[model samples]
Target chain A: MLDYPALAALAEIIRRGSFEAAAAALNVTPSAVSQRIKGLEERMGQVLIHRGPPARGTATGLRLMQHLDQVRLLEDTLDAALRPASGPATLRLAVNADSLATWFPPAMAALPVLYDLVLDDQDHARDGLRQGQVSAAISSDPEPVPGCDVLPLGAMRYLALATPDFLARHFPGGVTEPALRAAPAVIFNHKDGLQSRWVQKATGKRLHLPGHLIPASEPFARAVELGLGWGMIPEAMAAPRLRPLLPDLPLDVPLYWHVQRAMVPALTPLTAAIRKRAAADLRP
Target chain B: MLDYPALAALAEIIRRGSFEAAAAALNVTPSAVSQRIKGLEERMGQVLIHRGPPARGTATGLRLMQHLDQVRLLEDTLDAALRPASGPATLRLAVNADSLATWFPPAMAALPVLYDLVLDDQDHARDGLRQGQVSAAISSDPEPVPGCDVLPLGAMRYLALATPDFLARHFPGGVTEPALRAAPAVIFNHKDGLQSRWVQKATGKRLHLPGHLIPASEPFARAVELGLGWGMIPEAMAAPRLRPLLPDLPLDVPLYWHVQRAMVPALTPLTAAIRKRAAADLRP
Candidate 1:
């Protein structure tokens, strides 16, 4: 087993990429960081840090740092659970930008307990947890984080949303499969798989759209609302701003809830409160 | 959030169905478990478990217990990462029965290292990681356990594999989408999505198979190899045991690597060694 404090310090050092920077971040002396790492290596009977100008990690050191990252994530989750809910419990959560701009606020409002909320893109939020930043996350993946619990929150319904004008201008013939294959589309990010999934569904073939790729959640939604192109939008979020191009056709994407595992102790009350709120807020 | 130790204890209690039994499993006193729960509740300002003739989790408690279950899974993953290797720092990963019995071994061998080998199914062998079992795992999911790191290991190529006899018996005039839709198929497990993926590939339709749902990995492979039924097998795994029924047919599934994130520290040495051996062993 590695020393907890030393492991933590090493994580900071590796993340910061320099002893001096790590010392500055932790408000400790550079010498202290060096000494601690040396001590840790001596204890482990293996050299952790590779001594060089840039200062990269040895194979063993990187593994330990990864472990430390998980420990920190578990710690943050535990802190969230342990924090007294005298006021509102803080929910530092990650959600897709589309979900946040659309249905997330209502879900947050529907929570019986007051909560201090922080939201980010689903792709980046888990990184916050790994860095000891957040407590819970809503991800597109069904797999849970290592020390975290995962639950199927529910699927978010998406529709190929478009404005009446855009539909008239670009897809006048009722948006058939062939037209869809040739039409422009809105995507949240470069890695967005929705368009492909749609194409696969519509044409029975996987085709990549060479259309515009906008990364911002709200801007992307607004662009679609302004008739930039036909794009997939969460049904709940799209309900108020846009209408489904085809009222009968909707796409459903699964959403998962991942919470820290070690945080289970403190999570008991929080999960109870969150689950109650989620059951009411999330779509079945 | 919930109490870490307490929530873990609660999960054990629920799994064991008795405080005494849980205590024995944890090697602690029943009174200690009781005390831990009491402390946990006081910290959370909520009643979690309902103590009575048979101990049961309150609705809140059940939610908390579920969280703990996920946490335990992470811990198991962590344990797998930290396990000591006997000779080399290389890992012995177990894969799913279908993957191992099919295409994954070549991929594993194709890696750049010679790993101490053990192959199992996605369902069974993943437990090895949770129980301090293995160092790395190739799972069907992209999500990493809480304490683990995740990477896109790449996708597996699947082909409809069967003995010539099986194909002859089922589709005498050579297989087509319609014949496949009507024939009795072999499934590795009830939850196995290979058959469905294949169905969708062949017909652009998602249809559930009405054939045998065999759960065992080796037997499942043997069943297909022995002309039992037509099922999807990894392209590499199928190379020797069985020939592709349709060489030009398209059927593939993504494969992912879910490694203990903490194990990233050890990755430098581990990966280096694995890569060396994988160059000689794993198939492209």
Candidate 2:
């Protein structure tokens, strides 16, 4: 209904990183790309692009982009209904790398959609959805976006464990703040705080050991198993391997699912499937 | 010079996945996107795209994309030389996720370049370099790309370890193929063959355990330490944590660095920095 053409042109400029690159992708001259964005800005009564060498979308532009993404989703749904056999629906969802590596795929496999998966840290999962990069997302955020739906998906439990040799070598006496400080450990990424949070709770110390960081979930677990250092891990995963560094630590992480409020009937089935699957696999 | 615009258009189509998305990203009409590809194919006398709901680049297309990428890098170099006062060069490099979290950042920090890091499995790091997605790459491949120079960065050793409790519980008798199959192991991803390779060589058998996948290196180590299952880990990381499953099996993985042949004056300092740093950090 709105000027979708102009709106798309603005979004493209930001997505492509520069006007020149955007023009090349658009099959248009740089001037054309600029003109389209300018016209849209004039109409909206707000500046859209930052116009830097590496261009960025202004706050208003980002909001517009989010609106455009939502519109596209709704349009896709409408098109599917109008023409059932047009093509399979393409579903874009943002999720954590750990979930992607482990329990997430089965949940997705249960759905019949052309999935475009965007993997990120759990903390940033909702960001893609907010930024119009994904239609649905799973996050630790129980708070729903104003017009989005949210569902509780239970907790993912992590236990602190270490190899006998590692514990003996690193913490000969006991798990002390000094041992925690001195010992080389493994961290998922700069963003991951499960280990840090646990350390603070147990030892009342903020720990930042010279640790090996592996961003993906599977490798992080593998690194721990190879006795890199003591770290918090999912209880289910650590079941066979559990040599607890602490007396008790099932660092329970609560997870939640967030989806667009207005979606196709297809999304209903997807939401149901995910709820069922998460409830089954995750610690409720 | 060699229809760089058209070549970019073709690559954008494949990268963005759909003609509509490509058009939006490019700020061009869908018709223009098609025309650009069509014109490119006619000029080159080759089919560059495999037209589908989700489009993919053909061998020729992928090759052209790589070529275009190289040209852009060269142009960036030229620009930097012409304007030394310009901001730091944005150097895009592909590396193993483990290195990204470990030794790689320090290596980058030593340089003046603004790094755009691409993290992948160690084995797949070279693909991005070959595809021209990255200016340089660190890989396990000692073989140089046709025009790229290869530098040996030495080997990374991974020790197989598990918690004392885990080893005692799972392998009460002794560690063997059957016990391994039953024990919960941690792995990075399906692409990661480190665990599988070690298992095969050790037991002369294939394994597909009820393993937990923690894709990130740090988390994989953490998972392992939590007694999720045994895994291969960096020797440096595992030194304090070492409860070796196989006393003699330290999975020694050789590493290499590959850089574009054309880059020298700019790359010399980077190469020196990486060499000095890697030599200092890596296991011989």
Candidate 3:
């Protein structure tokens, strides 16, 4: 059996980013925190943490932290009352930027636990689950990671949008391939393919256009509204400030909720809330 | 001399992320694009592009691309005519999220070149310029990177804020150390030290509080507004919906614009606009 106190020290060091901070939180001395980590490392025969001003967990340390969380969650399930000693449980989840900006807060509000959110492109969020960095992820890929459940949440519709002035300046000849080639685009990131996919759907060709790479969802929409470039904006997030370039060709990216089979019980409330929100906010 | 056409092919392939996409952009056949890259790789005696479905440039490849950009920008400076063949020059920069969501758009509008922005914590954005991935960066660090010019851009005032209901629920006894320990925080990310710094300033203690990690600027502010947790919000972004937890103990983080000394002429318009915007938006 592992030392629960020592494990708690290790988890706190990783979470708070220093032995001193963890010691403060645990109401112990920094030397005691160091000694606990030293003993734990000796027993494990592996260097678990990288000692930085802001400390970080090694792969082994992170796995151990995850184990500690699982044990605490299981214990909490057995107990009827909240444990003030442990404080609130921290649940790490990977979610897309658009979801966090739009319909996701209700789901986050529904949960009692503290959250460690990893924001990534919707298509790439599954990597967080696959790599064991997160217990659950909101992904566009319908496929489930091993020992995980895939719940098909409806699709997020994205429209090719830009300011009316941008359209008038760049597409005076109409939205042709040549006009698109000349116009700048506002891309989310290298991982995001929504704009390119929408273009392929609209023009039946893959054309590379020079543009701005604005990774944040709100700023990306604002970039288009400010007439910097045309971009793909989520239907739920598309405001009146931007006009659609191709109203007829909307891209519906189907999303899924991927949760570890073991964590589903602990995450039931959040899952239920996500389902409720998605139903209202997404296209069926 | 290096083959400029082959170099253009390399830049296009890296920018577009595939040989076929590069071909589409350059108005050439995919095989011709492939041949050009093959010849360039042979001449350099190193692997340049990692051939994924979405291609990526190796470090040496990226350096060569940067050289190409510098040459083009220099030529554009000399000629004073926009070159339709090369398209608008793409300038890669690193910016803090808060600035991007608030005052940075006006500066972006003043420039004619396309932007590729890497959003990072203000404290860490300088790493992008140091690593040669970006020509310029907006950072809180006053120290300039080697061969870079640092322009002091004033400070962003941050207030410790939460919704009124959150303060009532968590701090019923008042904002004591114990109350702070019990109340949840809304942290921007693990790298963000504003909350910890503010706590130290207000209470003369570093309290490790459980919280939500919302990385995006707008969503992070929204999280506090939604009563998920309290966070250090930018003065420019603090909405009327959220109340200040400590109105007197505001944290002012000084920001600087770091640009490559060699690229100052190319970036003058952007620098002037950034200075003007910062003068209006940031605290003196």
Candidate 4:
């Protein structure tokens, strides 16, 4: 059998992408990470990592590492929940930009429980849970982790919006993928592909546009409202000022709540709280 | 604004927790869920659900409903490499037993991905993504979701195991909270927690008894193998197992998976092929 701790260290190195980075993340020396991976490989009787400047995982090593990742996550959640109270249970959570910008703040403010909030784009939030960084998470995935519980939060509606001026300048007449692609588009980040997906759905073609890449949540929304570019905005946020240039074209994405299975017992209160809150906040 | 779809109807009802599960889930059912909740309230809501579920937002409805679970996940993984496909690409995924055993499969597998695959018991399989989940997935979360794109795959892990021989001999050896509050223990779920949390770490109360729940992968490894007085397992399937051990102890519990958020684009032909194979063979 592999030395559990050493394997864990190796996995971390692979996860962090390099020995130095993994060491930095773990607050250990890179040499330690290197030794751990080397030891793990020798114990397993197989090479687990593909060494290079920026190291990668060998096939078998990657497989073992991935499995170790799951086991560790489950173990951590279970430990946190089952272990006696050391302090208030800190629920590390993730949320999307639009939700945080428009609705999450109120929900967070309303949360009666004490929690350590780690906010991020909804897409990135689940990563925290997988890495054993958080106990529970608000994710777009309704799917539960292996030993976890899942609650459906609901769908967040997205509307394609733009300031009257931006629309006039971009669309001129009617809105279509070609037109939108040609016009400058606003994105929370280059990774905000909702617009591209939307365009593809509308025109049956992929979008490869070069435009402004604003990297903040509130600012991204503001840029669009300020007539910087035409983009997809959450309906809840769009409800106030932004007009739906294309009403027929809308994007609706479902959301979910996932909690570690081991934490289920401890989660009763939290789940209840979240469910109650979701009941009041989400749109129909 | 988000696109509201009809498929979300049933899902929304369930999510909103009643006929009014949540309008956000239904997209067209706020009043519908309301009427449903109201009607159900007249019929069952009053009995099944409590009023003031949480807080209704500013004419926006459920404040919690505004939380987009999926978006949060996607955002976390947004930095990942784009899917190889042009249009709405299918996302192959990997997960574990606890997640599959719970309610998550439905929500995630139910989605209309271009293609999707879920690797079960991902505590050991996440490296498959080094092999790929098309784009991402739910795995035993540890370190980053791997490769830049990372997020929390919130779920829990539990330790529980038993064996026919052991049970026959022990017969409720401290089963309840007050009972075997001290006894032999087992930590079955593979690097999981049955012994550590419930016995030792939990308020420092030791099992003092004997035995260990050696973690196992599948059919042979469930709680029954170790003779631990019905250990903690994911709630989804634990109930059935408890049937045989009735009057002894209930073993159902929950676990979690912290997922990574790395997107290895399906750029290379080999990578693309593996992704395709994974989607076909791995999804639950």
Judged by DockQ, which candidate is best? 3
Worst 10 residues of 3 chain B by lDDT: B77-86
lDDT of 2 by residue, A233-275 (tens): 7776674654888876668888878886765344777778778
True contacts kept of each: 0.00, 0.01, 0.65, 0.00
Output the better candidate (1/2) by lDDT: 2
Candidate 2 lDDT, tens digit per residue, B162-255?
9898899989888887788667666665456687778877888755443554556665676667565688888766746549987887788888
Please tell me the interface RMSD, in Å, for model 4. 19.5
Worst ten in a row by lDDT for model 2 chain A? A83-92
TM-score per prediction, in order, is 0.39, 0.49, 0.92, 0.37
Q: What share of the true interface contacts does candidate 1 keep?
A: 0.00
List the global CA lDDT of all models.
0.58, 0.68, 0.84, 0.48
Q: Candidate 1: where are CA atoms >4 Å away?
A: A11-21, A41-137, A143-148, A199-207, A239-241, B1-284
Task: Give a tens-digit lDDT track for model 1, residues B1-284.
Answer: 65677886775565344687567546688999999988988987888776753466665675565454344433434565673331111244545544444333333323322233334456544555555345567676655565656655445667788877667776777766657755656665334667767767766775534344444444345456656567776655563767666678756555556665545554445444434433443433
TM-score of chain B of 2: 0.73
Error of 2 at A147 (Å): 3.1
Model 4 chain A poorest ten-residue lDDT run: A83-92
Model 3 residue A207 distance off true place after TM-score fit, in angstroms? 2.0
Q: Which stretches in model 3 have alpha-carbon errors above 4 Å?
A: A17-24, A27-47, A50-55, A80-84, A122-124, B1-58, B80-84, B122-124
Clashing pairs in 3: none
Q: What is the interface RMSD of each candidate, in Å?
A: 29.4, 15.4, 1.8, 19.5
* Cα error, candidate 1, residue A238 (Å): 2.7
